[model samples]
Target chain A: MSSEPRIFDPDEHDDVHLETELPEAELSDEAWETAALPDDLLLLGDQLRCDATRLHESHRADRLQHELLRPERAQRAETLVPARGISAWLPLLWLLPVVLITAALVSNGQPTVPRIPASPAVAVTPSVTPQAEYSPQVYSVSLPAETPSQHGPSAAELDALLDLMQNETASVAVSL
Target chain B: MKICGLDVEKLTSLYFDRIHRAALLMSGNAWDADDLAQEVFLIVANDPTKFEGRSSHYTYLYGILLNLERRLRRKRRMHQEKTEKLAQRQDGPTAAVAADVPVVSEEWKRSLWSVAAELPDGQRQAIVLRFGEELPYQEIADILGCPLGTVKSRIFHGLGTLRKLVAESPGQLREIPRELGDAQSDVI
Candidate 1:
């Protein structure tokens, strides 16, 4: 046995030394190639390789194949079922825009603010001071004063009144 | 040539058992291992294009499995913490109990595996990848997303831990070879 200091040289080819140090049957090719590692570590590596091989061999490969690798068509069908369910209502989706527009028009036509009561008690009155330059014209519209229980006008009537008021205002401005 | 343009069947055939074994070792149980393996394969199946062939396909698969394992571990840790808190609240000042007991069985491999499972996640992963999967240090480094030296250090420390654990139970050492036993002292 050469007890002399062996220099760390990759070039020094020693097949016999390698064979004696790492038996072919026990250690793997990778373990054999890692010559720099200690013999004990190499032995551990061999043990590891053997253990891994045993574990690998013990697994049920068929079970994995059956679970993971089903036919493409079956897989596609499984996946597409949800999408097909969604697509069944494709005709209904076209009505979305129409429904949305109708909602918008209905909302726009409705008066946002509720009409104030005609009762003078709740009506906000403007205080006027008597002065020669402060003389203002007052216009009064007669109302058929009714109890709060009676409905005043339908929404359509209110809309018609609003349109008539707007037209009158435009005509007065044109005349002016 | 390919399963849905991904060569998944080929990759699966090549590395399925290895991955499953790695998962088994990582999870410390067959049920979790099955779930982990199924999750890994599902990810690969869903988007096979993510594997760009930069590293070996096995390394790529292991990387995905490791990420999934980390997530699973995080969830397990959270659940454990909540359980511990609840336990403390309900049963005040309870003594800590050891999770792993010495194996009464004669099989040293099962004992060894259980001890390996007791190791910290990084060390356990290193040991499993090195010994259980037979991956080289560089490949382990790639799979772990760490430096080569880090991988070596992890394996060394992991093996040292395993050696200590096995030594704790003298009865388990009956099957260990003399040289391997001697090598235990040499492990730094």
Candidate 2:
């Protein structure tokens, strides 16, 4: 009932105001001692202390990579089991507008560059430039056709096909 | 590669576990804690200028970490809000999603740390730094960028809240009240 500043009396100390007069150094000590937590809180503290380490052991770089890459792993997991119903294609959903716009643009006008009439003085010839640099490198390799599987062409047919392929490649190179 | 005059790998190695531990205590999930820890370092690695030698590297990283924890908790709360029945939505697919997280006990999920995690960020950080990390109150004050008295008060109230929560629940504490979760968000 008194509004006056009360004097510190050790004898009248209750748990609530137990540390009001204590120094900062003794506040935690005095408070924790008197306001002692139950065994459960102590147990929790012990578990935390044991678990909360300040420094980790020397981890192998790869091991660190493995741990550090957990977010990537989560992303990969999300990717692995992509959204089943409609969500799976959510990423590609944006492409819908893109495709629609592309189609619209294509249909609106050809997607080709606008052809400019050549100046007569420039003499733009129709002769090939022999684009060896841009020609596709055709590697000659044996195909499954050489082995006559039930579903495969015979070796003779394969040789004919190879010859035809060579002819086509040469023609394509010459065209380039 | 070095940032803020410390090697990135060396920085990662030095405080990685400690940050993870602090984060784990703050977030009651290993997966989230691991992510938060990685993010703290990522931010440091990305922007070294944030560390202007004003505070120790640990404290600077901790400040970044706490900011991230706030953001993460906000995101989770949003997700939790969306999942309204987050309590009933335990185990199963969540476990599958957290496949790489170290196996933590379900019992721990319902422990004091879980409830402590629900404490206002200030109190939770104070409690974790004080009791979990066993740092001196002065150091906690430094890490939290608050007065020593504020740090002490936070830890004290944090523990008191923990006690009240335990007493109210009377068993493995689960169902955290929204009021309790929002009771304190600052270093009051």
Q: What DockQ results do all the predictions give, each relative to the true complex? A: 0.06, 0.05
Candidate 1 lDDT over B1-188, as tens digits, reads: 45344577777777777788788766755667878888888899888777777887778889889889878888877766776676687885433322222222223255456667667888888878877776776788788887655665566667666655656756844244435553442212
State the weakest 10-residue window (summed lDDT) of model 1 chain A. A16-25
DockQ, 0 to 1 scale, candidate 1: 0.06
Which window of ten consecutive residues has the lowest lDDT sum in model 2 chain A?
A53-62
Runs of candidate 2 exceeding 4 Å displacement: A1-22, A25-176, B82-107, B173-188
Clashes (backbone N, CA, C under 3 Å), per candidate, total: 0, 0
Off by over 4 Å in 1: A1-176, B1-5, B92-109, B173-188
Model 1 global lDDT (CA atoms, 0 to 1):
0.65
- For candidate 1, what is the TM-score? 0.48
Q: What is the C-alpha RMSD of each candidate to the true structure, in Å?
A: 28.0, 27.3
Best by lDDT: 2
Interface RMSD of each candidate, angstroms, one decimal: 9.4, 8.7
Model 1: docking quality category: incorrect
What's the C-alpha lDDT at position B135 in model 1? Answer: 74
